[model samples]
Target: MPPVKQQPCPFAPLIFDDEEAIGELSSVVLQLHDALSTNGRCFTTGATEEKAAATRGRIESVLLNAFCTIFGQSPFERFSDIFDQASYLAEHMAKDHIFEDGNKRTSLVFALSILALRNVPVVFPDNPDPKSNPYYAWIQDLVSGKRTREELAQELRSNHISK
Candidate 1:
């Protein structure tokens, strides 16, 4: 039998179907939904963590007022601004105890979309290697008060906007 050769995907520019690509998008949407619907339940199987519960309350209040307070604009802003806001919200929300599952995933998607809209250069892999990616730790640091908003903003500017 002759060996078969796979042709290049023409839609590569418009769409990506590799496991990484598919999982990348799915992870984002799933995480967002999970975080939103969790009702502040702790992700653990047994007793809920007190800090996590508190975080969830704080997250809900913030998400509810995200548009009015932070952006002072409608959610239907230009795609760029919308994305930036989403990213910011996702990052903040992930640190909170909003969902029993998928908080980080949700935040990552939000951040990626925001950067895409801003035309800022940010990198996010489909199967994110936590050891290499600074995103997860960044969010943790953010929640722990180790990283200030100004520092995060500066990082975004230096890494994405400036480039």
Candidate 2:
């Protein structure tokens, strides 16, 4: 008999300390990228499977392990909070150049989705001119590594409203 395909859970707890759970999170990231790539968004012109392979590997290795630390005998949590984890994920996705295009766009959407799944919706502060908003500069600082993950998490907390 052919094996039944398992569906990835979009609402799973933001856990990433183990290999198995990390694998699941990696799948979710890829699913997100796939959904965004063909939408006339950040995807590069003439994108190919070969380009996607690099992104997939980044998710499995760097993104999934961003919050992990080497303990005495095993890996341990560096950022146990979900917000911090989301920040790291977005940080790497934005700055790593995992995809040839849409790095910032994809990272922001993925991070926001992770938060939205937990019933917290981000509310961008009101700015008359969206192009001149400080939030964009803040995100740029994050992508450039000028802002730490903890700082990003705190900012995210401040910008969210309970839903």
Candidate 3:
């Protein structure tokens, strides 16, 4: 009998290094959805639930596309690092305003989730108040184009988990 060769995958491997990381991403997405839907901390104005779900779908699509070597778009640019990818995700999600509300929170959550999946520990201010958290304003700056992706990446690097 002759040996058989397997064909390469049509798309590039996802940002995740392994199945566990992929699973973590899935779990975080679900968590974000639930937190937004019921937490009352982040709420959408008109067509709230539907828009929230839509945003979730969009996030899933973006993550999937990040794996594609050829056809993928958005955060999957060539020679980009994980920080750049995270910054892209965060900026677009907030700027696009996919939801009537909570876009900023969702964007931050997605970015942090991506980092966490990559084993990057992102430390925010100890203050639980959003107004007191510098990251909130910083993310807004990113969305508004006042800040560059490199700036976001630098911030992430500064706060990287020592482990």
| Model 1 misplaced regions, further than 4 Å | 1-61, 69-88, 124-127, 161-163
lDDT of 3 by residue, 11-98 (tens): 2123543445545565575567558757786664545677656765665555554433435443335525676667767776677676
* TM-scores of the candidates in the order shown: 0.48, 0.68, 0.68
lDDT of each: 0.51, 0.67, 0.65
TM-score, structure 2 vs. true: 0.68
Ranking by TM-score: 3, 2, 1
What TM-score does model 1 achieve against the real structure?
Answer: 0.48
Superposed by TM-score, candidate 1 places the C-alpha of residue 79 at a distance from the truth, in angstroms, of 16
Point out the worst 10-residue segment of candidate 3 by lDDT. Answer: 8-17
Q: What does candidate 3 score on TM?
A: 0.68
CA lDDT of 46 in candidate 2? 53
In candidate 1, which residue pairs clash? Answer: 83-114
Model 3 error, position 25 (Å):
5.5
- Give the candidates in order of lDDT, highest first: 2, 3, 1
